[model samples]
Target: MAVKEFKLPDVGEGVAEGELVSWLVAPGDRVEEDQPVAEVETDKALVEVPSSYDGTVEELFVEEGEMVPVGDVIISFRVDEEGEADETGEADAVDEAGDETAAAAESEAAADEASAEPGTADAEPEPAAADAEPETPSGRTFAPPSARRLARELGVDLAAVDGSGPGGRVTEADVRAHAAGDAGGADAGGAESDEAPAPTPTDVGSGDRKSAVRKRGEDGSGDAPEPAGRDTTLATPATRKLARDRGVDVDDVPTDETRDGEAFVTGEHVRAYADALESAAATASTGGGSAEPTPEPEPVDVGADAEPAASDAAGDAEPAPAGATEAGGDETSAPESGDETVPYRGVRRTIGKQMERSKFTAPHVTHHDTAEVDALVAAREELKPTAAERGVKLTYMPFVMKAIVAGLKEHPYLNSELREDEEEIVLKKEYNLGIAVATDAGLMVPVVDDVDEKGLFELAEEVRDLAARARDRSLKPAEMKGGTFTVTNFGAVGGEFATPIINYPETAILGLGAIEERPVVRERDGTSEVVPAPTLPLSLSIDHRVVDGAVAAEFANTVMEHLETPLLLLNE
Candidate 1:
């Protein structure tokens, strides 16, 4: 037996450090090689860190929510090396392990992808074939729906299996390969020539439901009381939070799906249950003489108003700022009425730093305008059904994207970046546009490659797909990169004509305000009349260092022309 320390590997793209989100494995827990042990969030993504060697976890050095630098020893394992793979094989394992943030499948694939090294081109896997795969965004594994269902049926761990499908998706075939014990086929279908590891307590509902409480309690800490209906319910942490937020006991939600002999509860399940209760209450109220059952009282979180004392959670908690406490105080107290202190780290921190840099480093100028979009509106209505037939929802976004591309072509400065080190303005020929998506974590911009080549229906489908994944916190790092320009639709959330910020490095960003009916003067055949017309508001922001005020206004005009005339887009 030997003690081996597994350091936090550099999850590519030059990431120097990551904040430990949670420990998937605890001390004394047995973990297999390539099994995800912890989830770490870099500025780029939240990814699962896999164990490099198979062993009993001796101890974890880093606590939850702590920032750790690359190559720092995170966890130590007690391994019996007598029959283990050679040192060369372990090095290869280390490289494959750092591949992706266990990103969720793109709206349809599985919830696990390869660890953080982005881009499609993979370097040749080391000669050692049986060593590794990739792991997730948040804690959810990215696999297709079918692949997820299959893994549950086969009792296979998706975390241990490398994704072989597009965007590092773990397919059903890959699951089968792992189950069949053929580690030699890992690159093509993430597999290993060993029996599946027994289900650990960290994996909720993977075993007997009778062990529910014991299973969820990691180190006997942070475990809330399980409601009656929830005893046999299996759900992700996000799903549980959703249930709690909606005041629904997960146990009360009915699920027809069961994995490993336990009921599988999802966000959709909780929502449907909530809706049913609402309907029943309404029906009872209308009856006047009602006998419909009342829902059970929501479980009270006794610890909700209080955070753990600094003394109690010293290893995990960061020390209070000097001014945050009275002299010699050992804790940071809260208000009697329950004041919340959300951690200002992770994705939120990343957004702050990026915004700060852009605001301070570049001079910004915004150009706002509104185009009469009655023709654009009518054109969408005409083509909506055709798009629908192809299973796409035709929104005004695709038209706006097309218009932005046309504008970028006419004013190339809007699509160019200032290379300060080279002292040059770098112009890009490809039209990869990033569409800003509002997610639960924060705003993420998923780049749609080659916007100039895709048709309206294709754009609509792809945009919707990316947005869905973005909101669910499943977008890949690659999907978020390589944007020559960006578009933000504040209109979707009911905003109108606000100055938008440029997505720095890239020279500009186009903000779309709500399309509303407004009275405007129309001069036709020597007659003028004030008429209500649907107008789309546009706000274009540019870096003053790269694009001038006049040039920005000219680009906005080109965009408005395509939007107002509709048929003008054909000239592109």
Candidate 2:
């Protein structure tokens, strides 16, 4: 038999690494080729990594919650000459690397002894006390190094953790429970000698994702147990980061729905939790502010240029982010009497870096205009029944997408990407548009491939599906990549002619505002007549470095022309 190594494959295009979220298959488990062995959370999505070869899993090189880079060998498999999976698929869930290593070592020693003595095949080896938990002269708790490290990470005193392992040795699980503030305080157990060794940290599912945030009680008040990782909470890293940024514990975020047998927490859940905390605080301070909808703080703008705003008469309700300390000062920013410290990491940090690069690399310029869409509205109204017959909930977005595609055809530069390395502007002929779906505290832009070829209903269906999936963190990594242009409808929420950032690599992004009725003058029998018209506000932002102002204006005009004319989109 020989062993084959399997590396962490790239889950997303341009993705460098992913966090080893959890192992689906344990060591010694029979795995088929292309069998999903682990759940990895990459920058774009949480995906399952499949095994490359069929074999018995020999070892897992990385632990759960550890960030593993692409091309790094994460697992190994032992295969026979036939290159088939093991017939005996029995596995121990609690088994970790330490136990496996010790078992292998014992087997080797047994083979050596068998060669020396011909009749000792069925003999049991003598217990090795030295190899087991080494006894100390001092009365310190006999804990493994992994357990000690876990204790330090969880801020649990090893002395306070009750030992559950052989010979009263403290295990990582014991430390985890102690840190989670399990009922009944832990105390040192009387030492008892046993043959079996203690389980390692791999069994406990604790690795290098180190951070803490105090979880308040259900009603957002009173003493509560320390926050612990909820194995059931299945959220994208971005949603988790947003929770942390808002000073909310992700494990504590209440989730009702689940995806793939785990409680899936979205950005909406985190925002709701944070909002509830703020409201709870506000209600405590003011007699009955939270109950009134008017007193509830407006959801903060998450745009990059957004600034702190205290709209309430009471003022200063937003808690400042912790860990902000003066340079060289030993004192760090501390949370108030009822505050929590949250760590910023994961996809939020990833997006932040991308945005910073785009903003720094390309100078942005936004041109704002409005299109009279009275005819377009009537057309959509007429087509609504037809669209419904096809099982598509037709919306204004598809029309906007069609118009954007038409505009890109006229202004090819808008659909082009800037290649700084090659010093080339690659004009893309295929029209792939990104529809930015705004989550409660995060944003996702899932791309729709070949927008130019899709019909209105087809575009409508795909856009709807993509947007829904994006909000729920179900969007695939490929769906979020390879966009030539972007369309963000700030209108859906409530925005008018706001400047939007261009999606990096792509030259332009079009922002749509809320469609509203406005008074306008139009020619009637060669005389000007005042009339009410449904106007659609448009904001086109372009990379000033590559796309000139005149071209941007022309593109905006072309989009407006298609939107205003309505029938023009059918030809294109």
* lDDT of every predicted structure (CA atoms): 0.65, 0.64
Error of 2 at 107 (Å): 8.8
Residue-wise lDDT of candidate 1 within 367-415, one digit each (tens)? 9888999999999999998988988999999998898899889889889
lDDT of 1: 0.65
Kindly list the per-residue Cα lDDT of model 2 for residues 1-572, writing each as its tens digit. 44566788878888887877788865446789899999887778668888888766655655566566687667767555453221211111112212344433453433333212111122242112112322221333656544655554333555557889876778898888776784332221312111112322221121211111112232223211223347558766556656665655677676654556676665555544554455454443445433323233333323223332323333334432221112211112233344544334446556677788888888999999999999899999999999999899999999999998888988899999999999999999999999989864267789999988989999999998998887776778878888999999999999788988888988999999999888888999999999998899999989998999999999999999999999999977
- Report the error of model 1 at residue 71, Å: 1.5
> Candidate 2 at residue 341, lDDT?
40
For model 1, the stretches where C-alpha displacement exceeds 4 angstroms are 83-328, 333-339
| Candidate 2 backbone collisions, by pair | none
